[model samples]
Target: TQLLEQSPQFLSIQEGENLTVYCNSSSVFSSLQWYRQEPGEGPVLLVTVVTGGEVKKLKRLTFQFGDARKDSSLHITAAQPGDTGLYLCAGGGGGATNKLIFGTGTLLAVQP
Candidate 1:
């Protein structure tokens, strides 16, 4: 079983500041995904990266998959209070089940 781990488990920053979160694993995955969740809500998919060394952007946020497909990172620019939430990284999709291995999670608090 693959275990995904995220860095900076908790982050608190003021508005307009930038931050980066990392996800790592020792196993290679066919794909990786990022998600954000709010209190009492399920996580919402933010982006999915299927190729090694691929990078994707969503507004002020950027997501990158590692060249080895075992790591990923999320970067938010000029973070806003609205960006406050729980960030998660999931990896897997190598088999028919397509189950995902989720990371420990990162809780970000962007204060205005």
Candidate 2:
């Protein structure tokens, strides 16, 4: 599978803590998306960022795209146990196949 390269691949935090996860690539993407995956289900799309330097907020989470469309980051504030999951970023390039290159991922575990 294609990987987008993520940083801080594993994270262990207490409930109500804050964390930031990063996804990066040498090549620029047409768009980038973030997803949250639980243990037994398919990945759930969180947000899509198409423009450079754009930022979107969802409740306690914030998403940002790099200026050149080559990277993205996700920040979660006051995380809870319910937020524990595998967070992934998928970079969509302007290739013919339109394949989504996913990040290596950040496995977040929020302890109670």
Candidate 3:
């Protein structure tokens, strides 16, 4: 079974700070996705990367897929208080099932 692991399990920073979270796995995945979960809500999909070496940006957040498709990263620029949440990275097993393996997750807190 493939497992995704996230780094820096916890983070707390002031508003306007920059940070980067990483997701890595030994097995390669067909696609990778990033999500954010708040206190009382399910995770919200932030971005997805289907191709190796693909990079996608959403406003202040940037997502990148490694060249080998076995790793991914999320970088937040000038993070705001609203960005505080649990950051997750999921790998998709492309097929009929479309199964996904989620990483451990990163907890982020941005203080004002």
Candidate 4:
């Protein structure tokens, strides 16, 4: 089975800090998605990068997919208290299931 592992399961920082989270896997995926979730709510899509070596940016967040499609990264710049949430990376397989395999997640706390 394919699996995604995330690093620094927890993070705390002062407002306006910067951080990077990594998602890795041994299996290649057709597409990968990044989602940010707040407490007691479902995750909202941040971005989806499909092509290998693809890079997408949203505000202070930057997402990159590895050339091998087996890994991805999320970089946050000048993070604010509003950025505090659970970050997740999901991979989409090419099979008929087309289900998303989610990472363990990273809980970020940005202090004001």
User: Which ranges of candidate 4 are over 4 A from the true structure?
Assistant: none
lDDT of 4 by residue, 25-91 (tens): 9999999999999999999999999999999999899999999999999999999999999999999
In model 3, the runs with Cα more than 4 Å from the true position are none
Model 1 CA lDDT for position 81 = 98
lDDT of 2 by residue, 46-71 (tens): 99999999999999999999999998
Q: lDDT for every model?
A: 0.97, 0.93, 0.96, 0.96
The weakest ten consecutive residues by lDDT in model 1 span 92-101
- Tens digit per residue, CA lDDT, model 3, 1-112: 9999999999999999999999999999999999999989999999999999999999999999999999999999999999999999999977799888999999999999
Clashing pairs in 4: none
Error of 1 at 112 (Å): 0.5
lDDT per residue as tens, model 1, 37-86: 99999999999999999999999999999999999999999999999999
In model 4, the number of clashes is 0
| TM-score against truth, every candidate | 0.98, 0.95, 0.97, 0.98
